[model samples]
Target: MSIEFYEEYIESNKAIIYKICRAYTHSKLEFDDYFQEVCLQLWKSKEAYNHQSKLSTWVYRVTLNTCLSIIKSEKREVDTVEINESFDHHSDLEDTEAQERLNTLYMGIRQLKKADRAIIVLYLEDKSYQEIAEIIGISMSNVGVKINRIKQQLKDSIVWKSLI
Candidate 1:
């Protein structure tokens, strides 16, 4: 791929790239580092694009695999956090409530195994079962099963939290 093509690709898909970075890294520093590494890997692996899947799917596969490899090599501790993204347009109370719920949901997700976390993140991003299976190298049926189980686990966690 030409440099122009790679630059344009990164520009257009920056959000997905950043989302993967955020999902994997706990701190701002780590996020920055991971984002750079992902970009570098994408550039270096440009020749590996086989057109078997959409470019976005290929990007996801690359990003997730890169993150998994880094995590394994570093053996870094996973940090569980309450996610807080600001929406200034919303009323203060509504924003607070939304943020809290999102945080709780993310916290529950953080409890899952790494593989489950990757699957659920793709599902949340509205990727189809087939696409998710392709990216994660799992069967479509397995994707459905894992998503159902993960949803139930999240619900159970919420209920358990509420009772406490």
Candidate 2:
């Protein structure tokens, strides 16, 4: 693909890309790094997309796979880089209860297994089970079962957080 086309694609999918980065990265610097890498990988793998699914689904697959690969690599860093900018950009900051739930939910998600995290991210994005299965390369029935388990695990984690 041409540079202009790739740039346009990234611009159009910025929100989705950023959301994946935020979910998988622990720090702003890491998020930025992941975002750059995903964009590069997306462009590199553009030809592999055979139109078997929606373009967004292909993007999600690439993004998630890139993240998982980064996390699994031996050269991955353990120490997080601190960012100068605060990441408290919640849109509905005035709603305290909702904010707390959102925070707790993110905390719970961070503790999940990598594959489970991918599944839940898609679930939260309101992707259909079949779409998620396609992105994650799982069967639809397995996606349903895993989602149920992951949801229960998230609830347990959130409840535990409330106690503390």
User: Taking the tens digit of each residue's C-alpha lDDT, what string does model 2 give over 1-164?
Assistant: 57676766677767667767666776677778888899889888888989877888878888888988888784654332322233433234777777766656766776787788889989998999988898888999999999999999989877876797
RMSD (Å) per prediction: 4.3, 4.0
Off by over 4 Å in 2: 1-8, 75-97
Off by over 4 Å in 1: 1-7, 77-94, 162-164
- What is the Cα-based lDDT of residue 97 in candidate 1? 72
In the range 1-164, model 1's lDDT, one tens digit per residue, is: 57696676677677677667666665567777887888888999878999888988888888888888898899865644443442222123456778777656666776677888889889988999999998999999999999999999889987887797
The 10-residue segment of model 2 with minimum total lDDT is: 77-86
Displacement of the residue 108 alpha carbon in candidate 1, Å: 2.2
Prediction 1 TM-score vs. true: 0.79
Best by TM-score: 2
